[model samples]
Target chain A: MSILEILSYIGTFILLINTIIYSISFSFKKEAYSFFCVYLLIMLIITLLTTYYNSQKVNNLFLSHYYFLSQFILLSLFYKYVFENKKNKLLINTTLILIIYFLVLQYAMDTTLFQIFNLTEVVVTSLPLIIYSIIFFYQNLNAKVKFIYINIGVFMYLLCSMLLFASGNLMIELDPLINKIVWIVNASLYIVFQILIFIEWRKNYYRKIPKSS
Target chain B: MEKELLQEDSQIIVIILIAIMILLLMAVALVVFFFFSRKKIIATELEKANLAISYQKELLYSTIETQEEERKRIAQDLHDAISAKLNVVSLSTHVLIDGTLDKEEQAQTLQHILSVTTHTLESSRRLAHNLLPPILENFGLQATVEELCDEFMSSKKVFVSYDINYEDSLSKANELHIFRIIQELLNNAVRHGAAEQITLNIQEYDKKLQILFTDNGRGFDIRSIDKKKGIGLKNIESRVDILNGALSYSSELGKGTTFTINITKT
Candidate 1:
């Protein structure tokens, strides 16, 4: 496999390990943890299916479609759970409306089922996530250490990924070499997001245990 | 195909550049927001700390002032009531011991000594009572305040009149604090206000005691009363605080002063 392919596999592995560690650290009953676990689980499934499809030399655009749909649904629920204490009705309602709009666009738009990339869908889905991350960061500017790290991680990941994916389809059509480099960078950022989440989980775990002398 | 690919490449570059610019703007905005927010938080905390320290200093100064005032008053009382009367008794004894008078004259001298000694004992008792009134300990706050007002009236200090309607008695410590507050207010009215017809009203409602002290005196401007100079008012304020009470003072030049205190029952 190419170095880029290896890096993508490493990103998937990091995400899977992060989810496992988080699950061990916190109970699944909490809304925030439960929603996050669902999100990570979906991503892991998609990653595994994509790897399988690539080895089999079969198309995986259907899985990509599922990936976008699940992300829109699960990430919205995740943030809503995170901000449950804030009682922000506007954020919750906006997220719901955005999800509905994304679904309608995906069904109504004339797009190929086996298409290699869908830049419009990616941008439409990512823009709201970026806005939500920024809002979370602003609201929790003075929050605990773990929360600050989480907000930064979310904000940076969504922001950089949005930029990369917004120009990704054009890069592929223009130059395959540059497209590969952008994908590599995107994979690295995904790994960074996983590491940040792992750190936040570790902090929360230690916070629950009583310190010994 | 080559031309279209070149155009797409340029489009991608433009989009990437725009995204980078937006990201830099957001970073700058976030840094400025955090910087100002931290500065504001620090300033607020510092202001709160300063206010607490100033309050503590005021309390300490008032305590020291009350102590000094009490000591001076005690010294003056002893000199005027006990020392002078004792001097008279001593001189009368000297005359009786001269041994030059007839039996009737000596008997008259003995009677004179008895009168002087009795008067000296009464003066000593009055001085001790002024220090800590026994009436406050035995009778409740109402009776003690009534006795205080009657004494001021008999002395013709300022024609003091009081009406007390307190139903429940307070603890000894609380009553003593209330008594001292009333005494300080009356003293201020008599010495500073310098008018007649002082009225005191004490009532209890909903487990809270309220006292209204008003005087038809030549009142001075409340703003002109410096807290540092008026130790008596500070002492009264401290006593009111000890009772978990709130005190309000209102006065206008030549319009008479009024003091209102509301205390919660323990």
Candidate 2:
């Protein structure tokens, strides 16, 4: 394998370890973090499937649809636990259900579109999560913040990656150089995101719930 | 046409890079903002906790100092009032036992001894009363305050009018603190103000008790009252602190002094 391939796979490697560790933590102490644990596990599964399809020389771009769809759904629920405002939670949950239903309907109508990059789908699914992190930031000003690392990571990585993914089809139509540059940047950002997830688990969720005496 | 297409591709790349840079800057700015804000908040919290701790220490020191001062005052009163008078009586009794005088002389000596003994009895009773009034224990705060007012009235110099509208709902410790505060205020009025008319009003309403004490004495400058000299006022402040009460006072030169104390249910 070349250096670039190894670099890209490092993020995937960390993703695997984080999935196992989080699942273990969840079994010990079921908490709001359980939603996030499920999110990592889902991402790891998608990563394995995408790699498998790529090895067989099959079109794996279609999996991006499932990837974005599952990401929005799981993250919406994860932050649902973090948000204290009842109105914000209701809005997130209600919109989440409606958007997923519509996306499924759209896919049912046009199955061929899965192989193509959908900017509208990316924007619709990812934009609300960015807004949720911003709301979390505003809520915790000059106060003790909950899940600090996770909130920061979600806000930063999702924002840049969403922009990258939106421009993915345009880059692919051009030379391979543009695609390489975008994927390298995307891979580097993913490493940072996984590291942030690792820090959050080690710092907060690693300890077992002290049994009541 | 080919050149225009190339230019458009470069423009798109430029736009993407610029967009990524802006988003990256915003994320960094937010994280930095939270970081510095937390540092400032922790520093502020530490400062507040330190101030609270020092304030508590000052109050504790003042309580100990007031206790020492009371013990010294009681010691002086015993030596001057009871001990000195007993010494004089002891010499007179020894003279009577010597049998060195004739009938008239012996009678004069016995008469002198009788007057000194009677005088010592009254002094000791007054000293004991000053230590802790038995009336304060037997009766409640209302009747004891009334008796306290009558004692000041019998002095023939100060006319103290007490209006006590109370239900006696305070703990014994709180009542004692209140009683001491009143005693200190009255002493300050009589000794320092030299006032003839002293008005005291005590009333209780809905978990709150208010005491208004007024004296038409030669009032001093309120600003001139310092912690170093006005130990009586300081002692009153300490008792009020112990009771978790509020005390306010108004006094002007050539006018008078008024002290208002309000205590809540603790």
Candidate 3:
């Protein structure tokens, strides 16, 4: 297996472990963490499908689009869950508007699913998500909220991935080698993001244990 | 065509390198900003914690000093009031026991011992009453304060006028604290302020007990007075704190002094 494939497997393994841990720890309390678990599960499945399709020599760009779309939707849902109790109408409305915009743009522009990565789609979706993450940071800076760590994780991941995909299509057209390298960096950042989520889950697990006892 | 493609590729590499440099710089700047802000927040929190600790220490010191002063006062009262009179009684009894005198002389000596014993008993009761007045325990804060005012009035030392408008009484523990605070204030006015006339008013307003103590005396500078140096004021302060009350005092040199205290009802 190639180095990229190995890295991909590692990312998949981390996601799988994090999902299982979250499931076991918060099985009965699903409302609080269901969207996050779904995000993790979808990421794991996408990773596995991409790896299998690569080995079988089939075109899997559709899976890549699916990966981005599913992540945008599920991560948005997760954030909505995180801020469910907050009484800020503006933030909720803006998030809803951004999601609608993303869907409309993807449906209108993404005609050929097997074609190159939809750089426009990635940029459009990521910009608002990045803004939302920043809003989350600002809103919770002095608030007595427990989801600060997860918010930071989400913010950093969006920031790095936004920049990575902003220049993605240009690099793909220019040089496959550089494209591969950038994708590797993206994968590493995603793995780090997964680990951050795992840390948040582990914190919740330990926090609940004492209460349960 | 091949040469042109190579040139184009080199230019793209330069651009990518610049982009990567910008991103790296941004990342470094962000990390630095996060750490710097975090350090500032931690420092502010540490300062607040330190301030709270220092205030608590000052309060503890004041409490300890007040206890020591109380012990000294009790010891002095016992020595001067009860102990000295008891000694005189003992000496008289000893003379009676010697049996060197006539019957009339022995009878006179026994009479003298009885008189001394009666005086000593009164002194002991007075001291105990001063320490923790039974009037305060049974009759409540109003009667206790009124009795105290009457005692001062009858003493002809200082003319004290007081008004008690409070209808409800406090818990026993809180009543004791309030009584001590008033006693300390009165003592300070008489001893330190050297006041000839004093007015004390206590009333209940808006779920709070407001106490106003005013004295017309040779008042000293409120700013110049060291709170810790005068155990009387410090004792009052400690009691006010125990009662969860707020106290403020204003004094003008050679004019007068007024102390106001407001305690929230429990």
lDDT of 1 by residue, B1-266 (tens): 88787677766766675675577468557746754775676677788999999988988987887788789988988888778877877886787788788889889878887887888789888878878899877777788889999998887767987889986457889888888888888888888888688999999888889999999888877766863447788788878878889999898888899999999897
TM-score of each: 0.63, 0.78, 0.76
Full-model lDDT, candidate 1: 0.76
The TM-score that candidate 1 achieves is 0.63
In model 3, where do residues sit more than 4 Å from their true spots? A1-42, A69-153, A166-178, A191-213, B1-28, B94-100, B224-229, B264-266
lDDT of 3 by residue, B1-266 (tens): 97788679758756665666576567547645655666677678889999999978977887787778789989998999888988888888788788789999988888888888888899889989998999987888999999998887787989999999876468889988888888888888888878889999999987899999999987877767863346577778778888899999888998988999999997
Query: Residue B74's C-alpha lDDT in candidate 1?
Result: 85
The candidate 2 chain A region of ten consecutive residues with least summed lDDT is A23-32
The local distance difference test score of model 3 is 0.76
Chain B alone, TM-score of each model?
0.85, 0.81, 0.89
Measured by DockQ, the strongest candidate is 2
Which scores better on DockQ, 1 or 2? 2
Write down the worst ten-residue block by lDDT for model 2 chain B. Answer: B222-231
lDDT of 3 at A91: 64
**lDDT measured at residue B171 in model 3 versus the true structure, 0 to 100:** 85
| Order of models, best DockQ first | 2, 3, 1
Residue-level lDDT tens digits of model 2 in B9-107: 767777887888788888889888877877788789889999999867876777688779889989898889878878887887888789888889889
